[model samples]
Target chain A: MIRIDQLIKRYGALMAINGIDLHVPAGELFAYLGPNGAGKTTTIRILTGLTKLSSGRAALNGHDIEKETLAAKRQCGLVPQNINLDSELTVSENLDIHGRLFCMKPVARKAKINELLTYVDLHERSKSLVKQLSGGMKRRVMVARALMHSPRILFLDEPTVGLDPNIRRRIWSLIKKIQQDGTTIFLTTHYIEEAEFLADRVAFLDKGRIVAMDSPIKLIAGLGNWAIDWLTDDGMQTAYFPSRTAARESATAKENGFTLRRVNLEDAFLSLTGKKVQ
Target chain B: MMHGIIAVYLREMLILKRRLKRQLSGMAISPLLYLIAFGYAMGDAVQFNGHTYLEFLIPGLVAMGSMTQSFSIASDINVARFYWCIFEEFQAAPISNFAYVTGEVLSGMTRALLAIIVILALGLPFGVVLYYGPLFWLAAILNSFVFASLAVALAMLVKSHADQSLLTNFVITPMAFLGGTFFPVDRLPMWAQKILFLLPLTHASKAIRAVALSEIPDWRAYLVLPVTGVLIFIFALRSVKHARD
Candidate 1:
């Protein structure tokens, strides 16, 4: 569980994270959707205690991140946005160090490392050096390393950023399995489909503010069931319709080529903020 | 806190163990060259303070080697910070700033101790045996502590890995050459001696060389090393906190 109240983070003249509030109940997979520099990473950084908050309060489970830093940090595991695994270290060694940092007992650390390696489908590659592994494998190792402490919550910041579609799907399944196993996941990503497919609830953050927050299906439903996309002189445009027949009729009225598709989480975000998630 | 320190130290030791062969060679090369070039070239031809030039140079080389090796921890820290992003993993973990700093400082000291061992072993072939008493080791450790702590503090402050190199060039290099490592600080002009005396390495060189040469070591040199080490250690802790900000 996580709680944030009127959280504001300012970097000199720039408002990296404007006033925002959020609460994620235990075992919920919450996706924070935003474009580049939308304060998604900033919010995650604040919550993880990597960066100090300029104002307001944030707590992990019940521990205040500022006042109870070690306790709050112990409550959550973060898979950072980048591939930060130690390249020179083996997969098992990396996980072993994380366990030690969290003060896990040697036997418990070894057992957890074994369990997580299997959980992430990396047991076979546990002896491999991180640098020797492929991108997807490295990402899996990072996931396993983060989970070594058995933290109550996991903060995944763009976990599948550079992976191919197939690998992304695999990571998505792993994420789904994690949520099913009762770990609360706080994910920040720019990929609309990732949020739609994996998150139990979604928050669309724009310019350091949350413009929309709801379940993916409900957010998409708010924009209707069907979407008609067509290229115009200005740029690409889209319109939503409650029925496929209505969407087809709208597409037929367009002179240029058009696409008729189901309304997705992106349409909802665009409709609310007038900006693309990418 | 102890667990955090051990965890951090263990990571460094693991890496060091993995690269022990190459690191051993690296630790040997510079001192080997100094011994052959300066030690053999001036073997018994020169004497300083009632000892052969080789005898004088071995302890000086030990002091310089320990200082350089201890300070080299910064480069490793910078690499973890910039390339590997391993430092961020520590930042996100439950480890306190004090624990992190202490762990890194100990690792640096470990490297320094290893380098000292290599230098002492290298000295054996030349029949250059000297006193390696507890006091000698205390001076060595205190000297390593000062530089290693300084290294951690500077590692946090530098913006890039390149900046870390610049710091070595400006800070460590000068201290290595002028800190009574090559010759007696007393032999230098009064003004130069005064300035070099300000260097912790200079006191370390004096204390270590005195003990190795079977003389009564100056108590002042022992006092300076730990006092400077503690101050730099506090600076390192504050730097880690500032880095998080």
Candidate 2:
């Protein structure tokens, strides 16, 4: 569980997170969607105790991030946006260090390392140095490393960035499994489809503000069930219709050829903020 | 807090253990060259304080080696911060700033001790035996603490690896050469001696060299090392906090 109230983060003259409020109940998979520099990462950073908040209050499972930093940090595991696993260390060694940092007992640490390595399907590669692993393998190791201490909440910041679609799907399944195992997941990602497929609830953030927040299906439904996309002199344009027949009718009315497709989470985001998730 | 310190230290020790062979060779090369080039070349031709030049140079080399090797932890910290992003991982963890600083400072001191051991072993082939009493080790540890703490502080402040290198060139290199390591600070001009005396390594060199020669060292040198070490350690803690912010 996490709670944030009127959270404001300012870097000199620029606002990184502007007066946002959020509460994620335990065991929910929450996706934060935004384009580059849209404050998604900033919020995650603030929650995980990596960066201090400029103003307002944030708590992790009832521990204040500022006052009870260690306790708050102990409640959450963060898979950072960057590939930060120690390259010179083995995959298991990376997880071992994380376990140690959280003060896990040696026996518990070893067992958990083995369990998580297996969970991520990298048990055979545990002895391999992180640098020797492929990108997908490294990402899996990061996931396993983050889960070593078995924190109740997980913060995944762009966990599948730069991975191939197949690998991304694998990571998505892993994330789904993590949520099913009763861990609350707070995710920030640029992939709209990722949010749609994995997130129980989605928040679209833009320019340091949340423009909309709801279930992905509900957000899409609110924007209508079908969409007609056409290329115009001005650029690509899209219109949404409640029914496929209405969408087809709208497509036929177009001056040029058009495309008819189901309205997706990205369309909901674009309809609200007039910007691509990215 | 203790657990946090042990965990951080354990990570460093694991890495050090993995690269022990490379690190040992690196530790030996510089001291060996100094001993052969300066010790054999001078070879009792120069004497100071009723000792052969080789004898005098060994302790000086120990002092300098401790300073350089201890301060070298900064490069490792910079590599972790800039390349591996390991420091960020530590920041995200539950470790307190004090625990992180203590763990890193201890690792740096360990490296300094290992380097000092290599230098002493290298001195044995030349048949230069000296007292390595508790006082001598105290001075060595205190010296390492001062430089290692300074290293952590500067590593946090530097924006990039190049900036860290610039710091070494400007700060550690000059101290290594002029801090009574190669020759007596007293032999220098009065003004130069006064400036070098301000350096913690100069006091460390004086204290360590005196202990090795079985002489009562100036108490002020012992006092200066820990006082400076504690101050720099506190600064390192603040730097870590500032970095987190």
Candidate 3:
């Protein structure tokens, strides 16, 4: 569904996205994870044809975004981070105008707006002015706005930020449903758990570089902690470890018993980046 | 291109409509307030070519409205586009470069023309003659579009809303006032009037004043519309195309 090769973006002497190569297969939920200023947003902008890539190639279904931009963009929907919307316009009108932009016929446009509103659970609020709605409602409306054209792929840049946990979970569920309906979702998020739970494949970007790319479980198990936690009867129990060979022969093994448990993404993240998760 | 252009334009108008109570009031009243202050108050004191001061000032005010209102389009859009980030949504969509630029200019022109009409309507009772009514209106539309196109060109080159605001106040207002809108260019020295004629607003004001005063107007008035329109259109297209990848 997406291909990026040796993409490089530079501002004067600073590199925003450097030599990044990526492939997102059709119908896959791909999560792009990166720290702040890691060029994830820049990459998203470039792919959407909003910003120019300094050098390299990006194609959507083999249509180059730079050459056949309109056709390329027609294949993708982008939900931006800032929740850009027409606050004065009613929900229906906003969707209506966006649908019109896609050259959808009036009758079809009305039906599509209804379908999208229902898909986003915003049918009841369609008559209300966008400003009158809550923040989470506005975000959902934006999601519906992106889906108006029914693009084969959806790109969300930080879909959940500044929203409460409940809203975040709701959005996550909706995203899962979208993927199930066979739309490819490419998202960039700061929330590691979001990537962990939703992404079929995760790409870790740090400082304009992709450091790690793998499945969550394999990523965690590959870099093991093998932890066991228990409340000892005496409460002063110690833990033991083996480096190699019959390390149990050490006196530490005889002195204490430790439980073993599987390591998770946080462990792998810490191991790979050496930065503790907040 | 047309669909996307009009979609964004209609979308912007919808936003304005949502804030209708405020948008309608703000745009409608500012010109009337000017008419009352400059028209009624000074109509008794000022005289130009021996006409009522209100009548003389009304045309200038109309011209001023066109130029200043054009800036308002760019200014408000700059706020929504850069500060509020509404423009990025258009960027991320399938909207073409021409459509995006045209949509923006159209929104500005629409608002500017509406303001001018409201001002004209409000002045109808105050001996605001519409001699050559259609001609005057046609000229006003042409001039409004010219200023709007110029504004879009400037807006494309701007980096921030604050910078655009500073330039608008410093550049747009002075050009409107000195473009022979306030008084006749004949009042200026020979060299100064010649300099003023070089400005598109001068011809714009001439067209308005000629129609308002029931005069025939100079040939320059006829040329200003199409020439200025083409120049601004060409320059704006080049700017937008250069910025587009």
Off by over 4 Å in 3: A225-262, A276-278, B241-245
Alpha-carbon error at A3 in model 2, in Å? 0.8
Tens digits of per-residue lDDT, candidate 2, B1-245, equal 98889988888898999899999999999989989998888887888978998888888889999998999999999999988888989999998999999999999999999999999999999999899999999999999999999999999999999999999999988998999888989988999989998999899999999999999999998899999999999999999999886
For every candidate, the chain B TM-score is 0.99, 0.99, 0.90
| lDDT (10s digit) by residue, model 1, range B93-177 | 9998999999999999999999999999999999987998989999999999999999999999999999999999999999999
TM-score of each: 0.99, 0.98, 0.90
DockQ (C-alpha based) per candidate is: 0.87, 0.81, 0.61
Alpha-carbon lDDT of model 3:
0.79
Q: Model 1: what TM-score? A: 0.99
Fill in the DockQ of model 3. 0.61
> Which is superior by DockQ, 1 or 3?
1
Docking class of 3: medium
Best-performing candidate as measured by TM-score? 1
Give one digit per residue, the lDDT tens place, for model 2 in A1-278. Answer: 89999999999999999999999999999999999999999999999988889999999999999999999999999999999988888998899889989999999999998899889999999899888999999988988888888889999999999999999999999999999999999999999889999999999999999999999999999888999999999999999999999999778978889999999989988888888889
lDDT of 3 at B107: 79
**Tens digit of lDDT per residue, candidate 1, span A75-146?**
999999889988888999999999999999999988998899999988998898888999999988888888
lDDT of each: 0.93, 0.93, 0.79
Provide the lDDT at B114 for model 2.
99
